[model samples]
Target: MKRKCPKVKSLLLRLLLFRQTRPVFTEEEKTEFTRLYDRIIQDGGIAPYDSSYPKFRFLQYLSVTKPLLFHGSNYQGIEEFEPRRQTLFDGTYTDAVFSSADGIWPLFYAVLDRSGLTGNIRNGCIVSRRGERFYFFSLSVESEDRYPWTEGMIYVLPRDSFRQASEGKLYFDEWVSEKPVKPLFRLKVSPEDFVFLSRTTWHRSTEPLFKTYLLYKWRSKFGKRK
Candidate 1:
């Protein structure tokens, strides 16, 4: 039997499992979100954009360099969780201000629901261990690049690429290099839109003005079961 190509496998998995949708934000709500986003940025809510090595503090339980691992298969198996990663990004709010439950949770959840993963909102974050996967959420703004007229560019490495990096098959740096990598997902997103991502999906944004609707980790429900 021929072995499946990793890039092809990744694309198939994304097509079968991943879902992306733009949430419907009312005119008034959009205005409010924009206002809040701007306030956060002015107060230094944005992070410095590093085209080379992009780092984001997603939550208190996540680590910038390490990948989260879980035991068991997605359908039926044992369950365990590593703590989430939390490192402050360049323009992110200080813990004191960011931890508040007021601003973005409601809006974010509304958008996440559009992507078909509904969960309770709590403490400015959401973690759902519905079964074998983890559902995480965060807020981000797009970045402004000075050269190449690149504004709000986000680079994402597929799950397979990340796996290679983790297993020493490929250096993480080379995997994330700016050179165009085929079968990769690249986009210029707007702050008005909410995006859902996977934890294993390596992604980087340019400056500040983007929103991260959700980050999930699990064998997608659509994956073939063993």
Candidate 2:
């Protein structure tokens, strides 16, 4: 793996490293530059569905009436948040800290990880164009045999540094800040509390990791045609 490639070989071979887009996501946000955040949110981890429970009340509490802004992650003890360049195309186009007015949206990032999976997991969260909230989760056969559950954390940030990033027309409810900010509170969220994962359209792909990256690049290139 230490071998060096000749310039010819390197150029002829589409290593695709520089070709990958680099968006300034939050520090703990783990994703390929070519991959979609929505795809990552749901396709990022393996989770179990709660057939016994009929509702996700905590998620509802977070999404509906929770005040202040919210950010979620798989890591803990993040005392400070630095502004990074996030070009999400959701209209939050600046170097800044990002969070959502609705807590449930941040939960999508909190409750998922690729810790032991050999392949992608089935998962996603969405608020419909019609205002319906939804989420879903399932594991690949290999993942099911390897890991049992998903773990994540939710951090509540002070809103003094935040500003509405997107217009209210789409009702996206996204917020951003160009300066560094610190969390006022952090909580370890249970997978059961994330029952909201079963809500929106789930995005799942079991392709090998390399293949998925190439596929994402291909799509990004072709989808940009005028």
Candidate 3:
């Protein structure tokens, strides 16, 4: 199968142009965060991003990675999450355990460029049991301005699945099975700024109201794409 090359320009635009830098929490502020983490774990598991009208079952697994910090600072910003994996057998496809390695941590922010459509979707993340590993699917939409036509939905699939989708062996429509097609709540963000959680979700930005930027450490595996 021909491997799909990463859409460098689009990825860079989302990471460097639309992302907003989050404020670093101070050590004193971390006290509350620690408490919140403990409280969440104590309450069985943190509810899925949306629970009011749950369509998918998303339970919190332990956090395995730490937060990504800003350059030359002790301040921590973005966090990484580790989810439980599962195995599956499609009958047609050889039975295999599906799992996703946590990608490099990311810093998320959004721009309010007001040049295109802005919307949200619910059940943004999906997980399927496939044995000892789990298959993950994540999606997000980006709104952009005129130049490169910046708006579209992004789907992140397990590595193998991503390859298949890119090869045309698997169609994106059939591959993605999301309930509550649109997000229940809209994230009010300016074209200049947006927020993101690095670990569990895949996100994108459109309608470039303002230039968005992202700062993150490079991983050897993914290379220096940005």
Q: Identify the leading candidate in terms of TM-score.
A: 2
Encode model 3's per-residue lDDT on 1-226: one tens digit a residue: 2344333333443443222222244454354445543554344221222222111111111112222111010112212212223222222432322222221111111221224435421111111121111112122344222321222211112232211211222211112111112111111122122122222222353423222123222211233222
**lDDT, each prediction:** 0.24, 0.49, 0.23
TM-score of candidate 3 to 2 decimals? 0.23
How many collisions per candidate? 22, 11, 44
Q: How accurate is candidate 1 locally (lDDT)?
A: 0.24
Look at candidate 2 and tell me the lDDT of residue 99.
Answer: 82
Q: For candidate 1, what is the TM-score?
A: 0.21
Q: What's each prediction's TM-score? A: 0.21, 0.49, 0.23
Q: Estimate, for each residue in 119-186, the C-alpha lDDT of model 2 and write its tens digit.
A: 44433233323343332333444544443446777776667778876542123446788889877555
lDDT of 2: 0.49
How do all the candidates rank in terms of TM-score, highest first?
Answer: 2, 3, 1
Q: Write the per-residue lDDT of candidate 1 for residues 90-202, one digit (tens) a residue.
A: 32222211111111222232223222222222112221111111123422111111111112322222222222111221111111111222212222322232333322121
Error of 2 at 91 (Å): 7.8
